[model samples]
Target: MTTIEAPSGRTTTPDVQHIDVLVVGAGISGIGAAYHLQHEQPGRSFLLLDALDERGGTWRTHRYPGARSDSDLFTFGYGFKPWRGPSIATADEILAYLDEVIEENDLAQYIRYRHRVTAASWSSEERRYTVEVTREDTGEHLRFTTDFLWMCQGYYDHDKPFQPNWQGMDEFRGQTIHPQQWPEDLDCTGKRVVVIGSGATAATLIPAIAESAKHVTMLQRSPTFFISRPKVAELAATLRALEIPDEWTHEIMRRASFAQGEELWRMSVETPDALREFLIESMRPLLPDGFDIDKHFNPTYRPWQQRLAAVPEGDLFTALREGKASVVTDTIERFTETGIRLTSGEELEADIVVTATGFDLSLFGNVAFTVDGEPVDFTQQVTYRGIMITGVPNMAYVFGYFRASWTLRADLVSQFVCRLLTKMDEQGTPVVVPQLRPEDADMPLLDWSDPENFNPGYVMRSQHRMFKRGDREPWTHHKEYTEERDILPTADLDDGLVYRR
Candidate 1:
């Protein structure tokens, strides 16, 4: 085994492998990073390490019935590859599409599955990051040194879904389940199920299992904004009918989707009341006549305050109209033996309960990080364009957009990282870090994100654990895709970045 001497005069063993770049998480972001690295920087050696046993990060982990993409595939799919499927695709369909990308690009060889990264430490003397990994299959520990670290592990805790504890939960005899860890053996046939929460997971699950289950009821303390649209993209369909190239169709549809997304965001900002009315009235026709839309469908928060759940073809409303599913907007007093008791003096009887609350945010895959000999405190640092953090050297993470498709931002970040790498090669520099400028010493720091802009339950719950952001550009994590698209491509690399040999 190749041994390397540690900074403390201790010898580290077990064969240390070295690479030019180490991409963490073989999911969508990581895969995209690998593709860009291979295509743009062919001379750089890179490896992808994922904790899971396979690829397709979220798609693989979420196996609930009717699990699908909330965002349209045209924008969600990679820029280089074209999405030939419907706008909103199922999890299986997404996994298949990812598989094709891997096969076409031959990226499987560079990916190491089931290798969980435990910790990462940067060495200033060597100008590299040493990442410690644990092989899940054989329980073997390994180390890899790399000049650059790309974090694509995503932002949620996969193993532990946010399970809110209600009073008398233990006393309830029904089978309790969270969508994150759905049990394959459990059958919902002819069961009366009550799902808690009004987010995307609950929106997706209720319609999916409504037909099979005897009855499904969605219980929520408050309502969320929902947008229903057809699964097929009219422009994409028209282009394909004319025998236009797949790549051309993809680009056209992607831009159209972006434009539509921009309009929605504009409506939310400029005229929120009009946008809210449009959303509510759109669902009125699909729902049963005289349904309590205001009580169940209306949200107190303004449009775009939280993410708007997209229901393809109004499937959720269809389920409600067919009497297979229903929605109850009320607070839960406690869980009962049969089901739950609401604060309104009502009881909901059920044989099963699904908590579609949310998931805990896992910043940087919950990996402990150290710079030189000092432990890095992420909450104390400010973000640099939401990619690189202050005082963290040779590391960049991909945190996608909340309003727009995630891959749109992922693609931009990948391009920027590649550009940075090219500049480093030209300057013969091995280390680069984001540092504050002298004039910016007194800059005010704020929460990771503005609640008014985007405040989901999960994000609000974990904002304290995230890195701070400044009020100015290059120091903030702006969520607008149109603005970022214009700014990121030609961003000055040396603005806040300090490069060293």
Candidate 2:
């Protein structure tokens, strides 16, 4: 946020806001970045811009029934702030946590809500970015100039979810709903609900709606790994019984989760077959006797191929055992008047159909970028520590870890950005860009296109659009939080980057 005057020699007006550092999106990443900027670089002036009217990003936007944390809260929460509650938390609980962070950190004064960014133009002459945005309330256009642009809006398109082109979808008489657009007056009581796509959304919704819905059937083209977890925290309880503080308990639990996740990946590489069997057998008792574990629970891919969805209190399995819920692993042939017809020659009746499909993942929230009035294609660039694109200067985007808590990486990114700015201050440098080495051109490139590499459905669909990763750092992501933790914090900025005054 260290700055001089605008290089264009333009004077600031009432509608024009001049900032040293502007962090986009007021969600988890933006808030964390703001905190780091305030604490680490106290002299820098900054503000947060969110497209929505409020903050809390995903947690605030997704309010579907049974919407909660799929990952443990201890790690999901900010490193500075302790969750100090259940392993998995509801959306409201998380939103409240974020509110508390903002209130305690006094972030409210710096946040300018309802500023939907449309495009950004980087001016080499000015050494600044001219950001164009629209005020949602009045549709008024405003401009802002900033020394550094931090994209913390996340990597997904919030405008729409991915909906497959299914035949006869419009002909169905039953109500069709997408979890991303869940209605406030949605009536599922005593109704037959068919939740489609067995990802986190389906896993969360089926059990939640099963309590009141006459019957809930989870229909998926392919099965996903679902692991049931108890509501109580055994480790935490034991630790607190011995008089240890809740904060200490949270740290211990966090590290334990990290180690377990790393071990699971290791097992996947060494003994995938045995590990798969072990995981399937672990869930046998939860379901009714003689259940087909291979067909419904076991995914076609090897274990750790994708993230496992965590279910609370074994509610999903209990619902299945008590015959209140069922799962169907088949392709949707078409939609009938009263239900959906499967390709396996089966028709299931449903009063309401919820498409719990994945998101339309986009890089930098689909922000249009122009360097010196020329549009930049990020796909041709290499990422630096998965934070900054090679050709993009004085900009960093926050992309969290896939396996572990997202904030774990966000926390590191915040620290790195702060240090980067401080180093720039000391060196009298105003610009930093990743400069690919000469030999890097001969080095092989990697993409997240294949499921074997990084097989999340969301990424697979948009792999071609994302920036390429090299075989090694600061251009590649190892996908392991432990390795990233060891590398990113102390990673040298000049390794593949160029600094300019």
Candidate 3:
């Protein structure tokens, strides 16, 4: 193994280790990448590094009550792994599934936890990346050099959740909590709680805390669209009853879920009005009679404009109907001593306030990056098929779909990366970078995503910080899974990439 030299002008250390690939973030994407690397390129040396002490990234970090999968597990789970649990599974269940994948594949040996990557610098002359990492467990700094950089660190700032500063927030007497950093000792039993937000986090938290809290109120500036479905998939159950193989059942259910999601997406794009009516009408019966569905459940934007929060078994609606929880649709004027004062001059009393307001978007896990001693300003660059960035050599990141299951794209990107690695080995090329072709030099640069197509608050807030997208194939990033599923596997690797020895 080649020993990595310390940053230029520094003495080389014998302790520095070099590998063929270094996969960052031992979460869903990283774990999946490990599986593919081992299965596809068994001879390649690779390591999986995560900042956290555990494997599940989001699942491990989010400890709020009722933390669960918003998307069906059939699609969210790895394509290779057979998901036999309910379509909507709890965080514990998802983590358990991930554990199974690690154990079954013997991936634990490859993972090194508590290693947070601080900076990565690519050296074209050396044909490798020199990654600096801080060991959280010991506070010791270390380095690793790799021929390929596989970034699976997710897009959200796990350490800093986004909490809008309401007036008089500091003067409030009750404890304020953000779901991203839920206190383990926090107990809502008999406490009057007020949750602020209308997104999936608020929707999931309200129902989970309602039964224990004296009263829970979901305070939102506007409404969000929700879709309620059975927790268990009927077809999967039926197939199991018929004694079909687990692998076959998993594949069949996954395809069915994908088709259903495709139809919903198609309706949202082609017939939004009709789809909006269907979603609102479907939710009407689940809510209490005389409840202001328009004020509490309907959103001003079209369906799928942000995200359609899934309410498994209508649990959130059940809490609302049973009087365990309530929805208040109004803007907060400011924070009162006890709770919040609304623009309409109404005061809410609460013993605890939970801010489910979302989180800041983090690109490349907020790691500082440079190429050939020059800093990399991703915003000035463009993405190649949303996996590789233009001018960033030997690096690929997994930024999953917002409209569908994240793991679906994660699986696809992993497979593509493995294929690219195999081709590089065959060609004896040690470096590969994406470059804009002359024909596409005049292509109009656009936001990382089309706001009209998919504009979640997080993406909108951080769009300026992300890489740009162009108006053509091999430059665009936000393609639907149906299109990507067919396109990515056979995509021409040489279309926009430059390979070097």
Candidate 1 — worst ten consecutive residues by lDDT sum? 3-12
lDDT tens digits by residue: candidate 3, 1-501: 344445553333356779889999988899999999999999999999999999999999999999999999999989999998999999999999999999999999999999899899999888899999877886666789999999999989888999899999999999999999999999999999999998989889999999999999999988999999789989989999999998999999999998999999999999999999999999999999899998888898988989999999999999999999999999999998989999999999999999999998899999999999999999989999999999999999999998899999999999999999988989999889999999997899998888899887888999999999999889998888999998999999999999999
Query: Model 2 over residues 205-306: C-alpha lDDT tens digits?
Result: 888889899999999888888877766578877887898987788889888888878888888889999888878887888998888878999998877778
lDDT of 3 at 141: 68
What TM-score, computed on C-alpha atoms, does each candidate reach? 0.97, 0.95, 0.97
Error of 1 at 233 (Å): 1.9
Give one digit per residue, the lDDT tens place, for model 1 in 186-283: 78999999999999999999999998999999999999888897899777889999999999999999989988899999999999999999999988
Model-by-model lDDT, in order?
Answer: 0.93, 0.85, 0.92
- TM-score, candidate 2, is 0.95
RMSD of 1: 2.6
Residue 55 CA displacement from its true place in model 2, Å:
1.3
* Residue runs of model 1 more than 4 Å from their true location after superposition: 1-13
